[model samples]
Target: MLDNTKRQDIKVILQQVWGYEDFRYPQAEIINCLLNKQDTLVIMPTGGGKSLCFQLPALLQPGLTIVVSPLVALMENQVQQLQQKKIAAGLIHSQQAKSDRKLIISNLTQLKLLYVAPETLLTPPIWEKLLQPDLMINNLIIDEAHCIVQWGTTFRSSYTRLGVIRDALHKHKQNKITIAAFTATADTLTQQTIIKTLRLKKQFKKFVINPYRSNLQLKVKTVWTAKGRKKATLKFIQQQHNKSGLIYVRSRKASELLAKWLREQKLNTVAYHGGIINSKRRAIEQDWLTGKLPFVICTCAFGMGIDKSDCRWILHYHTPELLPEYLQEIGRSGRDNKPAIALALISEPTGWLDNEDKQRSQFFTNQLAKQSKQAKKVFEILPSQGNILDIIKEIPDSELALGILQNLDLIQWQDIFNYQKKSSNKNINSVSTSQQTKQMQQFLQTKQCRWQYILSAFSFIKEAKDFKCSKCDRCSLEKPSRIISNK
Candidate 1:
C-alpha cells in the first residue's frame, strides 16, 4: 500500500503530466508495487491503462527505466507519445541511424525511460553501452511480455534470453534492479512461461484484471468459398460507412490482395505487414490514427502498441491459428468503451468448399515441425558447453535453434552468452502444435456465448463458468444469414 503522501504525489504527477486526476482500478497499486522495489507481473486488458502503471512510476523514480519491448513499432509509438508530453524518453532499434543511437546512448542517464526491442538490446553496440560503469539503471520492464512465450522459440529468439538482463546488468551496479512485465492476454501456461523465462522472483506480485470487455461483441460467420468470405467482409465494411477498423489476414500476399480488392470496391484502405518497409508501415499507421484512412488490411504486425480508440469494428478475413491471437486481435476494438464488433470468417465444416483456414493451419504446423528438426540437428553439432556468440559466428540460425532447444528443456544458459546442454530424449516439437488450432476450431463451433468460450480457453474458468454476455452473436436474439446464397 502507498502512503497517503506518496499516493498524493502520484496523483499530482498524473494530473500535471497526463491530465488524469486519478488512477484506474489497480493501476495505483501496480505503480506502488514498483515504487516499493517489488518485482511484478501485470495481466490487464488492452486500454485498461497498463502502460500508465509503469510510465507513471518511471517518472516518480530516479534512475533510467529500461523497457524491453518486442516490436520497433511498439517502441516508437510509445516513445513518440512520451516525447509529445515533453518527457525524457527515447528508443533504440535497428532501423534508427547509428549516429542517433549513439546520441541516445550518450544521454542514457538523462532519460527517464528507454524503450528497446530484445534482439537489439542484446546486440554488441547497445549491450556494451548499457554495461558501462557510469550508467545507473532502475526498473526493467517487458512490455507485450507475452511475445516471449509466443515468439521466443522461433524468429524472436532473443526473448528467451531476456532473463539475462537482470543478472548480467546487476553484476556491475550497486543498486538492485526490479523487473515488471505487462501484457493483455496470457493464460496459465503462458503466464508460467513468462515467469520462468523472465526468471521473475517467487515473491513477485501478479495483478490480473478480468479480460472481459462488455462493449465488444463477438461473432463468427461460415462461408462456403473464398469469394464468399471476401464478399462477406466487404459487406460488413460497407455497412460501417467508413468507420475506423482493421481487416486481419494471415499473410502478406493475402493482405495485399485483399487491400487491392477492397480498393476495387472503392473502399479506402491500405495493406500493412512485415514485408513492407518501416517508413511505409509507420505512414499507414499514422494515416489510420488521423482518420485519413478508414481501415487497414494487415497481418498481426499492425496491432501491438497501436493507440487508436473508437475503432468500430475488426474483421477476420481468415480465422487465426490460435485463440490467444484471436483474443489479442479482437482486443483492438471497442477500446473507447463504445460498441464494436469482431467477426471471424471461417470455411464450412468440412473445408471442402474453401480450405484456406485448413491450409494455413497446416502450413504453420509443418513449419513448426521443420524448425524442431532443425533445432535438434543444430543441437547435435554443438559442443557439450560453449558460448552462443561464438557458435552463431560459425552457424547460421544457431541462436534461434538454441532458443528452441532451451524452450524444450534440452539446454540451459549458464550465463548471458554461455549454455550447457541437458540430457533429454524428449522429442522436439513434442509440445502439441495442433492443440491451439483445435481450440480455435472449437471456439468457432461452440454453441455457448463467444465471450464465455474465449474466457474458458484463456483459463479464466471462474469467469467463463457463469459468463453470460447479452451482446455476443450466440446470446443476441438476431442471427446473421449464411454468407453464401443459392442463385
Candidate 2:
C-alpha cells in the first residue's frame, strides 16, 4: 500500500500531467502495485484508462520504463501523447531510421519511458543496449497483453520469448525489475496463456474488471448472401448518419471495396488496413479522430491506441474468427458512457461465405501443425549459426520456423532476421486453433441474449445470467420494436 505522502504525490502528478482530478477505479490500485515492484496483469476494457495505470507509475519511478507494444502506429501515438505533456519519451521501431534509433538508444538513460515493438526489442542491438551498466530499466510493460497469446504462437514469435527478458535484465541490474501486462480483452484461456508465456512471478497480481458495458447494445444479424450483408451494414450507417463509427472487415480488399461502396452511397469514409502506406494510414486516422470522416472501413489494424470516445456505433460486416477479437472491436463503441450499438452481419451457412471461413480456420490449424513438425526437424539439423537462406532451402516457411525456435529460446537473433542457435531442444508445442473458431461460430448462431453469450464466453457466468443489459437485440425483441438511435 502507498503511504500518505506518496499517495498525495500520485494525485498531484495525476492532476498536473493529465489534468484529471482523480484516478479511475482500479487505476490507482494498479499503479500502487507497480510502485511496490509487484508483477501485475490488468485486463481492462478498451478506453478504460489502461495506459494511465502504467504511464503514471513510469513518471513517478526513477528508472526508465520499457513498454513492449505490437504496432508502430500505437507506439508513435503514445510517444506523441506523452511528448504533448512534455514527458521525456522516445520510441524505436523498424520504420525508424537507423540514425534515429541510435540516437534514441544513446539517450535511453535520459528518458522516463521508451516504447518498442517486441521484434525490435529482441534484436541484438536493442537487447545489448538495455543490458548496459549505465541504463536503469525499472519495469517491462506489455501493452495489449492479449497479443502475446493471440500472435505469439503463430504470427510474431518474439512475444513468446518475452518470458526470458526479465531474467536477462536481472543479470545486469542490481535491483529486481517489475513486469505489467495490460489488455482490453482476454478470456480464461488467453489469461492463462499470458501468465504462462510471460512467466510472470508467482506473486503477480491480477486485476480483471468485467469488460461489459451496459451502455452498448449487442446484436447479430444473419444475412444469406454477401450483398445482403453489405446492404444491412449500409442501412446501419445511414441510420447513424453524422455520428462517428467503425466498420470492421476481415481483409484489405474488403475494406477498400466496402469503403468505395459506402462512398458511392454518399457517405464520407476511407479504407484503412496494414497494406496501406504509413503516411496514408496516419492521415485517415487523423481524419477520423477529428471527425472529418464520420466512419472508416478498416481491418483489425485500426483499433489499437485510438482514443475516440463518442464513436456511437460499430458494425461488423463479417463476424471475426474469434470471440475475443469481436469483443475488442465492438468495445470500441459507447466509450463515453453513452448509448451505442454493435451489430454483426454473419452469412448463413447456406452460402459459401461461412464455409470459406470455416475452411480458412481449418487450413491455418493444419498449416500450423505441419509447420511445427517441420520446424522441429529443421532445428535438429541446422548448424549453430548459419544464413537464413540455408534453413529456408531445407524447410518451407523457414522464417516462421526460425521464429518459433527463437521464441523457445533455442536461438537468438543477431540482427533483424539473422539467428544464432543457443540450444538444441526439440520439444515443440502445437496450439489448438479450432476451439476459438468453434466458439465464434457458436456465438453467431446462438439464439440466447447476445450480451449474455459474450459474458459467458469470457467466463463471467454469474453476471451473464443475472444481468441481461436489456439493450441487446434479444432483450429488445422481447419488447416492442424500436429503432436504435444516438442518445
Candidate 3:
C-alpha cells in the first residue's frame, strides 16, 4: 500500500506530467508494488494504460529505469513522449548517429528513463557502460514482454538472454534489481516461457486483466476467391470512408499491392512494412497520427507502442498466424472509449487455394526446426572469438544460431554481430511452433463467439456458464453480412 505522502506525490505527478486526474484500474497498485522494489508481471490489453504503471513508478524511485523494447520505432516513440513531459529520457538504436549515441550513453546517469533494443543492449560497449560505477539502474522493464517467448526461440534470440543480464547486473551492482514485464497478449505457454526464461523471482507480483473491450465490434467475413476478398475489403473501406483505420496484411508485397489498389480507388493510404526505410516509416506513422493518411495497409509491424486513440476500425486482409497476434492487432482500436469495428476478411476454401495457409504455417515450422539443427552444428565449430562474416561462410544461419547459443550461455558476444564461444555441445528445441499455428487455424474456423473463444484460449474464465459477446458476428443476428461474388 502507498503511504499518504507517497500517494499525494503520485497524484501531483499524474496531473502535472500526464494530465490524468487519477490512476486507471490497478495502476496505483502496480506502482505501489514497484515502489516497494517488487518484481511484477503486468498483462493488460493495449490502450489499457500499461505505460503509466511503470513510468510513474520510475519517477517516484531514486535511480534510473532501463526499458528493454523490441522495435526501434517503439523505443523512439516512447523516448519522445517522455521528453515531451520534460523528463530526461533517451534511446539507443541502429539508426542513431555515433555522436548522438555516445552523448546518450555518457548522460545515462542523469536520465530518468532509457529505452533500448535487446540486441543493442547485449553488445559489449553498451553493456559495459551500464555496468560502470557511475550509473544506478533501479528498475529493469521489459515492454511487449510476449516477444520474449514468441520470438526468443526463433525470430529474435536476444530476448532469451535477458535472464543472464539480470544476473550480471545484480553481480555488478551488488543488489537485486527490480524487474517489471508488460504485454498485451500471452497464453499459458507464453507466460510460462516468460517466467522461466527471464528467471523472475518467485515472489514477483502477477496481474492478468481480462482483455475484453465492449466498445470494439468484432466480425469475420468469408470470401470465395482472391477477387472476392478484394471486393469485400473495398466494400468495407467504402462504407467507412474518410474514417481513420488500418488494414493488416501478412506480407510486405501484399501491403504494397493493397495500398496501390486502395490508392487507385482514390482513397488516401500508405503501405508500411519492415522493407520500408526507417525515415519513411516514421513519416507514415506521423501522417497517420495527424489524420493525413486515413488508412494504412501494413504488416504486423505497424502498431506496437503507437498511441493513436481515435482509430475507428482495423481490417485484417489476411488472418494472423496466432490468436495472440490477432488480439494485439485489434486491441489498437477504440482506445478513446468510442465504438470501433475489427473485421477479418478470410477466403473460403477453393480447390486451388485449399490448405494454402496450413502449408505456409508448416513451412515456417519446418524452417525453424532446421535452424535448430544448424544452430547445434554451428556451435560445434565456432571459435572462441571471430567476425560474423567468417562464421556465416560455414553456417548461413549463423546470426540466428549465435543468438540462440548466446541465450544458452554457450557463447558471449564481444561486439555488434561478433561472438566468442564459452561452452560447446548444447541442444535446442523449437518449442511447439506447429501447435501455435494450429491454434490460429482453429480460431479462423471456430463456430463459437470470437471473443469467448479468445477468452477460453487464453485461460481467462469470468463465469462458469457460457457467455457470448453479442458484438461479434457469431452472436449478433442484427449485423448484416457482405459477401462478394467470385465473378
Which candidate number has the best TM-score?
Answer: 1
lDDT of 1 by residue, 23-117 (tens): 78888889989999999999888888889989999998888899998878888989999999999999998899989988999999899999998
Sorted by lDDT (best first), the order is 1, 2, 3
Candidate 1 local distance difference test against the native:
0.87
Global lDDT of model 3: 0.82
Per-residue C-alpha lDDT of model 2 across residues 428-485, encoded as one tens digit per residue? 7543567898898888888777777877888877666655556777777474232221
lDDT of 2: 0.83
Q: Judging by lDDT against the true structure, name the best candidate.
A: 1
Of 1 and 2, the candidate ahead on lDDT is 1
- State TM-scores per candidate: 0.96, 0.89, 0.90
State the lDDT at 308 in candidate 1: 94
Q: In order, how many clashes per candidate?
A: 0, 0, 0
Model 1: lowest-lDDT 10 consecutive positions: 478-487
Write down the lDDT of every candidate, Cα atoms only.
0.87, 0.83, 0.82
* Global fold similarity of model 1 (TM-score): 0.96
